[model samples]
Target: MEAYVVATACTKFEKKPNQTFKGLTEEVYLDLLREAELENGDLIGQAWFGNCGMGTFGQRNIRGQVCFTPLVNKKLFPERVGIINVEGGCATGSMAFHGAWKDVVSGIEDVSLAIGVEKIFQPDRPDMIQEIYDGGIDQFDKDEWIKFYKDVGDQLGKPFNPEEKKGTIFMNTYGLQALWHMKKFGTTQKQIALAASKNHFHGSLNEKAQYQFKVSVEDVLNDREISYPLTRSMCAPIGDGAAAALICSKKGLKLFTKEVQDRAIKIKSSVLTGGKYRTLDEPGLSRIAAQKAFKQADIIQKDIDILEIHDATSFCEIYQLEMLGFCDDGKGGQFVEEGKTSLDGELPVNLSGGLVSKGHPVGATGLSMVHELSVQLKGEGAKRQSKRHKYALAENGGGVIGFEEAACSVIILQSPF
Candidate 1:
C-alpha cells in the first residue's frame, strides 16, 4: 500500500525561539497537527521523531516522549501512540520519515506522524562541531578518524594537505571530491561559484530560507575559503528548524477535507540505502535510492521535472546529479556548467536552495526538502514555483564514516488524485 503525505509544516530556522527543546517541539507539533486538521486525539498510532542537537541541549533518550506528550493527551492516548527516535547525522529527518512510511505501508498503523526538530545555537563553535562529530558513536576515537582523513588524502595524491584532513573533520569532505572533479574535468572555480550564486538567488525568493540575499559568482569565489575549493558560501550555515509531515494510508485518507485531499501528494516510493563503510570513492546512496524509486514509480530519468537534493556544498550538488542519473558519471561538473540543473534548465534541482542557502538544520533538513517539494507539486511554492512539475525527488544523506553515507533516504512524490 502506497502512503501519501496529507499535511506538512516547517518553521524557519532563523526565527527559532530561545526556549528549551521540549518547548520548541511542542510548538512544532501543535502547528503541524492543526495545519493537518488532525486533533491531538486523532493521532492514535505510532509517532516517529528525529533530532540532532537534543543531547547538546541536555535532552537524552527520552526526547521524543518529552516533546510530544505536551502537545497530545498522554493520559488518553498513552498506549496507542508509540514513540521512536532516530539519529542519522544530517539525514535524521529523512530517516524518521522513512520509518513512518514503513509502518504505514506494512499496515502496522493507519496514521503516522513524522517530526524532525533540532536546535544548535550554542556559545562555542568548536564544541558544537565536536558534539556533532561524536554523534552517538561508542568508539569515539578522534585520532582514528583523523588518520582516515590522511588515508583519503594519500589516495588522492594530496598527501600532507591539511585541507583534506580538515575537510573530513567538518563535512568539508566534499571539497576533496570537488578538487578531484576540477582536476579531471577542467571544472573551474567559477562554475562552483555559479552554483552557489544560483542557490542564493533562489533562496532570496523563499521566505523560509535563512540567507535570502542574492549573491554573485564572484562573491562566492572571493568569500572566505573554509577548505580549499570550498568557500564559506558553499557551506551550510548552522541554525535551528523543525518540520513535520502527517502521512496516512488510503483508508485513513478519507478523514481529511476535500481541500486537503485536493492538495495531497502521493508517496510514489521511499528508498533507503547505504554504502561500504569508511569509503567515499563509491557511487553515492542517492544513486542507489533513486534507482529503486524510479523502478517503483514506473518512471524514467526524464520523467522527473523537479528535485530537492542534499547540496551541503557545491561539490555535493555536482556529484549527486551524476549519481542520481541526471547526468553521466564524472560529467556532473560539465552538466552544471551547461546550465542543465538550473531552474529553467532541463532538470531543475535544489529549487528550495538546498542546504547551501536554505539552512541545514540537520534533523529538519530532509523533511524540509519534502515540505518544499510538496508545495511545488501543489502549485504553492509561490515565486519559486516550477514551470512544469509532475514528479519530484528528495535525496538526503547523513554522516560520513569512511567515504559513503552512514545513512541515506530518498523519496519520490507526485500529485495525488
Candidate 2:
C-alpha cells in the first residue's frame, strides 16, 4: 500500500505495422517523462520490461537489452540500471508494475519504471502474427492447443482446419465457454452483444482504440462470426503498443512536486496468481485472484467506481464480470443489459474501450488498463472522464490452463486526494 502509480502513459493502441517494439517503448517513456514532469531518466532506480511476442520478430533470449539499449543508456539513467524482461501472457504489463511496486514498497528504490511493449502486426509476414496464440503455450509442445481445438471441433461434429492459424486460440476457448454459459444459465446472445455495444460506444470516445466506431447490439450479432455467436466485432484486433507506469514510495512522492502528489493514485491492493485446474462447475483462478485482491483492499466490489477488465471477447466481458463479483452468478449479461457498466452508470467499466475495441497487443494491455484508471482518477479523462473516479479496479489475465487463466492480476487503486 506504500507504493503509488504517480505517473502513467501509453502509446495509441493500434496497428503500427512499421514500428519496432523498441521504438514503441521509447515513445511511452517520453510520454511518461512529460506526464511526470521529470527531466532526467537517471532518477529511475530499476526497470521492469514486459513483452509477449519477441520470439516472432527476433531477440528472444536477450529481450531486455534488445528493447532498451542505447535508447535508455547511462547518459540518461544509471550506469548499470537493472532491467528485467517479463512475459505473463497478456498481463505482462501488470506483472512489470507489480515487480516495480515491490521495489518501492520494500524501500529498496525510490523511483522504479514498468513498461510493457509488444509488436504483433507484421505487414509482410502476416502468418507470424499467429504467435499471439502460440506465445502462451509451451513452444516444445506446439500441437497441444491445436489438438484441443481439433477435439472441440470433433465434439461439435464440425471439421477442424489445421490451417486455421489466423486468430488466437483464446477466442476458440472463449467461444466454447460462451456456449457452456448460455446452456447452463440461459444466457442469450443479445446479452453478450449489449456488453460489446457499450464498449463500442466507449471506443468511440477513445481515439487510441483500434476500432472507434460504435455499433448496435444487432450490428454486433449480425457481424461476421469469428467462432459462431462470437462476431468479429466482438473480438480484440491484433496490434502493437507500449504502456509505462512510474511507481514510487511515499518518501519518493516527496521528490515530486505537490501537483504530481495530488494526482497520484494509491495502490491499495495487488494480487497475482497462476491458474488452478477446475471442473465445469468450479471456480477459476481469476475469481480467486479477485477475492484475494478485494480482501487485501478491505473493500467490496460495490465500492469500485470504475473498472477496466480484459475483454478479449464480449463473452469474456460477461464471464469476468461474474468471476470478479461485479454481478451474481450467470447475471453478468443482465448487469450489462441494465446499463450498470456504462459511463453514466454507477460503475463505468472499460471507459477506454478495453481490449475488444482498444486493441490488445498482449504485453501492453494490463498497464494500458492502469493508465486509463490513472487518468480517470486524476480527473484528466476529458470527455470520457467519469464523475465517479474515487476507487477503481483493473483485472487482466494471460494465457490459459484447462478452464482457467494461466496467470491473472487484480489491482485496486484509490484517489490520493
Candidate 3:
C-alpha cells in the first residue's frame, strides 16, 4: 500500500507566552480533521506525537497521553488506536511523519495521524530557552561544550563575549563550522546574510510566519551579532506552535471527498538515518540522507521545484545547499548569492520563511515544513507559490550529537493530480 497525504495544517507560529500545549493541540487537530473532511474520528487508526519540551513543560513521561486526553475521545477512535511518542531534537515533527508514513505503507493501518507540538515560551523563566535546547545534546558533555565556547575566541583570534550567545549552544556549533567554511572556501558573511534576507522576504509573504517582515542583507549584517559572522536576524526565533498531517493508504483514498483526493500529495521517497562520528573532513547526515532520498525517488536535485531545509541558522542554508547536491562543494554560498534559491530561481527554498522566519518550536518544525510544501503543491502558497511545482523536498535534522545532527529525515513529495 502506498501512503498519501490528504490533508495538512499548522497553527500560526509565534511567541505565545500564555498558550499551553493543550491549546496548540486542539487548534491543529480540529483544523486537520476539517481539512481532511473526516466527520468521524474513527478513521484515524493511530497517532504519533512528536515533542521536545517535556523538561520545560513538566510532562516527560506519558506526554502523548497528556496532550491527547483532553482532545481525542477514546470512544470515537478506531479499535485500540496505538499512540507513540517521538523526540529527536528539532526534527521531532518529521520523525512523527515517518512513523505515520510507515504505518500506512506497511498495511498496519489504512490511515494515521502525525502531530508535532511544542511550547517553549515561559515568560517567568529567563533560562527556559537554554534548558530546552540542552536536552538535544549529551548532558554529560556540558563541561566540554562550555570549554569549547570559551576557547573559540582565542582560536578565532578575537575576544569572545558570552552575551553573544543570544540563542542556544547549538548556535556556537553552527558558528564554528561556518567560521571554518569561511577560512577554507572564503564564504563571506554577506552570503549568509543574503540567505537570511531572502527568508525574511519569504516570511513577509507568509502571514503565519513568526518574523513576517522583509529584511535586507544590509539589515541582517547590521543586526546584533549572535556569534561571529552570525547576527540575531540570521537565527531561528524561539516560539510555540503545532502542525499536523493526515496520511492515508492508496485504498484509503476512496473514503475522502473528490476535492480532498485530488489535493493529496504522494509520498515518493522517505528515508531516515543516523549521524556518524565524523572529523572535520568527513560527511554529515544531511548529505547522506539527501543522497539516499534522491536515489530512492530516482530524482535529481533540479527535479525538485520547491524545498525546505532545516535552517537553524542562516549559514546552515548555505551549507545544506552543497550537502543536498544543489551545487558543488565550495559553491553553496554563491548558490544563494546568485539567486539560485530565490522564489523565482531555479529552485526555491524555504518559501515559508524557513525556521528563521517560521519559528522553530522544535517538534512542530518538520510538520510546518511539510505543510508549506503541501500548500505550495496545491497552488495555495499565494505570493510565494512557485512557477515550477512538480516535486517538493523537505530535509529535517534532529539533535546535536558529536559533530552533526544525531538523526535526519528526508522526504520527497509529488503533487497530486
Q: In terms of lDDT, which candidate is strongest?
A: 3
User: Which residue pairs in candidate 1 collide?
Assistant: 278-402, 278-403, 279-403, 280-403
* Residue pairs with clashing backbones, model 2: none
Give residue 127's error in model 1 in angstroms: 1.4
Q: Please list the C-alpha lDDT of all candidates, in the order they appear.
A: 0.78, 0.85, 0.87
Q: Single out the weakest 10-residue window by summed lDDT for candidate 3.
A: 71-80
Off by over 4 Å in 3: 74-79, 143-164
lDDT of 2: 0.85
Error of 2 at 387 (Å): 1.5
By TM-score, rank the candidates, best first.
3, 2, 1
Which runs in model 1 stand beyond 4 Å of their true positions?
15-17, 73-80, 124-126, 136-144, 155-168, 277-281
lDDT of 1: 0.78
lDDT of 3 by residue, 1-417 (tens): 578998999999998988888788888988998899876567888899999986576788878777787665644334466789999999899999999999999998888999999998777886876788878887886666555545654666655453555667777778777887888798999999999999999999998999889999999999998877889999998898999999999998888999899999999888898975566547788898999999988999879999999999989899988888888887889999999889999999999999999899999999999999999998899999998888999999988765688899999999984
How would you order the candidates by lDDT, starting with the best?
Answer: 3, 2, 1
lDDT of 2 by residue, 36-137 (tens): 888867778999999888877767777866677756573544567889888899989999988998899889999999999988888788668776567676
My TM-score estimates for the predictions, one after another, are 0.92, 0.95, 0.95
